[model samples]
Target: MSSARRHILIALDMHSATDAGLSTLVSIARRLDATLSGLYIEDSQLMSAAGLPFSTEINYLSAEERILDPEELLRINRLASAQARHLLEELSARDKLECTFAVESGKVAIQSLSIQGCDVFLPGRSRKSLTRKQVTLQLRQLVLIYENSGIFERMLEVARLLAANGMVSDITIVSETPLPAEITGKLSIEDVRWHFQAVSSTRPEQLRALRLNSASLVLMPKDLLTNLTERQWFELLEQLPFPLLLMD
Candidate 1:
């Protein structure tokens, strides 16, 4: 686990909603007194596809088809990166929190995971979500995937802060085994209820199946996700309706 003064990294893209990730990030940063960092990603694969002579672009809102131009895509990425940096600068100035920003060209998820020196990673909503029906994320109940007492301790700290900030009343622990006494003793918060969701293991399929509607935020430790590949992590984040925070 990282120290309270560790860095919190946020992964963003052109379609990202800064408010969703930054609000949570700022809250946690203030609570932990941590520094903030932003990573703006440009999809290299999309840029390559746009370079194809026969490649075409279709408007999601309108049914119009147009030629995909790599140069235009690159320009758009630059604009998005500029906008992201501006937002981070504003956030840093407003919150008086240390902030850093970087732009990388590659697979968004892979690039984010490859970054070093970050203690915690909060990935913004997937760009694919733009085409789907939007669902409101209310922080009423939080789902935490428990691995062990050590990791759970760290997860609980953030969960508690989020619960307090979001006025969350219940927190559910999804675990393969029952919590030991050492772990259960920590769940005695006043006015906050705790529940458990049993799973066979922390496999990708089981974890995906446990996405209950009541959960507004899901917290999972990076240690428990040893079975997931980089691509799987990307897909998982893309499919989740609510945000998932991964702690190292």
Candidate 2:
């Protein structure tokens, strides 16, 4: 089994979108025989902002301005964090997954620093409906999105890991141009399959189109991701609703 453990930082709040993606985390953990850890951020900013004496929000349901208080915010954070821990324990234990969870009190993005040593992980949630069969993505849809060979080897390494765990059915290498044969031939993970496709001219638009339903996991070079601003990152995420593995 591959020792490349995948850390999936997710919110377990019943009302949060991450709660729905919890199943995907379990599936990946079980398949990879990896440790599945969860982190729930007790956002301090929300509490801090609400603590302002004049802070108010028009409650969408009631259309009434609601005053905020520090005491009540603390109470809500405690309750939410507790619920998240309980849910994580129950679900993870049910699957016999080696799971651990932590609560960080800060911005959602900054909390990810806890897993900085990880080689790869799901940094956000994917709304793509996950099924038991697709846990390891048996759909044979593994897409590596990139522009060059600088990180092609790393992409193939991750793909091999997926194959080792039987998390991949087939792999698709999507690039701006065709990759050299010597590089393509190196993607030989036993009993695994893959193919490559290069777009003619446009890249971003074509890439978005391919991401819609072309793959279950989009593997990308971590450095390449820097090309996107935070907003663009989430926008691309919305397009590719499936899990994304950003690797070094």
Question: What lDDT tens digits, residue by residue, belong to model 1 across residues 1-248?
Answer: 45546677777777663554556555556656678888888988889999889899787558799998898989988997898788677767777899998888886666665666565455445333321112223446778888874767878887676666544678898888988898888787667888988888876546558755422667787655556676786666655555666676
Could you tell me the TM-score of candidate 1? 0.80
Report the poorest 10 consecutive residues by lDDT, candidate 2: 11-20
Give the alpha carbon lDDT tens digit for every residue of 1-248 in model 2: 33556554453322232443565556655664556566666667667888777987675447898787778877876777777667667778887877777776764434453355443444234444455444434435778785565556766766776688766767887777767778766877788777777766433324567644423667775555545445564465445455555554
Q: Candidate 2: RMSD over Cα atoms?
A: 5.1
Off by over 4 Å in 1: 1-4, 57-66, 124-137, 164-167, 205-207, 212-215, 225-231
Badly placed stretches (over 4 Å) of model 2 are 1-20, 43-84, 94-96, 113-115, 123-140, 147-151, 189-193, 199-208, 213-215, 233-240
Which candidate ranks first by TM-score, i.e. highest?
A: 1
C-alpha lDDT values of all predictions: 0.69, 0.59
